[model samples]
Target: MPAPIPTKVHYHKQARELELGYADGQSYRLAIEYLRVFSPSAEVRGHGKGQETLQVGKKFVGLKDITPTGRYALKLHFDDGHDSGLFSWDYLKWLIDNREANWAEYLERLEAAGASREPLGIEIRQL
Candidate 1:
């Protein structure tokens, strides 16, 4: 079976999110920061397991543009200068399905490294 294609793809700059709507009446919102941190690029995912680089201080990263890669993937340009990842349709679906767990795991990894999502010199406001 082929991976599903999104019927709608809209980037909401004000919300800093990408909204995807499917044919089955399902929809998902992916934060720009989340996409940047979890990019499938070798720089982020690494060449092999256990070699992945931890992406920190990307809480404010923005999407500069999105370009299609043939018919199977998307090339996402990040304002932070990263644009290597090819987000395939399958990968996008996987991201949406595992978003919650992935996010939690990312936070755990950051905390373990004593890192903050906030960019350098930016203070994290505690409520």
Candidate 2:
């Protein structure tokens, strides 16, 4: 069976979300930050297993553009100057199915590494 592709794609800049709709009346709204942090690019996923790079300070990342790569994938251009990942239909579906678990794991990893999703600079201190 072939991987399901989104029938409709809409990027909500103000909401910083990408809404993907399918023919079966199912739709998913994925946050831009989530997509960026979990990008399939080599910079994020790395060259092999256990080589994946943990993405931090990407809470405010935004999508600069989204281009179709033939009929199988999407080339996402991020405002942070990252434009590598080729989000295939299969990968997108996987992401949708694993969204919750992946996000939770990412959070756990961040905590373990003492990393903040907040952009590189500026700190939040409570007195």
Candidate 3:
């Protein structure tokens, strides 16, 4: 089945949150920091599933720029010198819907592995 179309997008600079609204009368929220840290770029996501790199100390990160890639994706340039990810529309929607669950899981994994987003740079906060 085809994906639902998005009707609107809102970026709140003060809240550092992005809100997405769909034609199906659903809305999703995604934090700027979360999006930056989870960028799908190889530099951040790594070569494979287990090879992912951690991002750290990016509470203040923002979208410096965004370039649309066709009709289905966007190339984001984060303020923290990361510009490699091509965020597909579907991925963005998924992140918004699963933000809480995904973040909680990532936190658990970080604790288990003694990984710090600030230190190890994937799952912990330094600032």
Candidate 4:
């Protein structure tokens, strides 16, 4: 099957969101934190099946920036200092397709673990 063309793409820096438009007339707005927690990299996704890590304390995260990998993918830099995930067209589609269920699952896991998505381990010095 031939690849579908992208109609429009926008990155909102302050909002830390990526919006994509497709020729099929569907658009998606994805948060940087959502993409980070669901990264396809071994660092985030692990190397083997059933090894996915439940990323916590990342609800407030956002996208730092995006670097294009030619025309096929984007290298995402995350606010939590995670820059390993390279999102391709196919992967992005999968994420879009599964956003609702996956987000619900993440929330359920956090609740079950008695975990908070609040920030952790960062010391801020206020003068």
- Candidate 4 per-residue lDDT, tens place, 68-92, comes to 8878777887767888878888888
Worst 10 residues of 3 by lDDT: 118-127
lDDT per model, in order? 0.90, 0.89, 0.76, 0.79
Model 4 lDDT on a 0 to 1 scale = 0.79
lDDT of 2 by residue, 1-112 (tens): 7778899999998888999999999999999988998999999999999999999988877787899999999998988889999999998888899999999999999999
TM-score of 3: 0.79
Instruction: Name the lDDT of candidate 3.
Output: 0.76
Minimum summed lDDT over a 10-residue window in model 1 is located at 118-127
lDDT sort, best first? 1, 2, 4, 3
Q: At residue 87, what lDDT does model 1 achieve?
A: 93
lDDT tens per residue, model 1, 23-106: 999999999999999999999999999999999999877788999888888898988889999999999999999999999999
Deviation (Å) of 33 in candidate 3: 1.0
Per-residue alpha-carbon lDDT of model 3 for 2-67, expressed as tens digits? 456567877777787777788878888788888987888999888898898766666677676777
TM-score of 2: 0.92
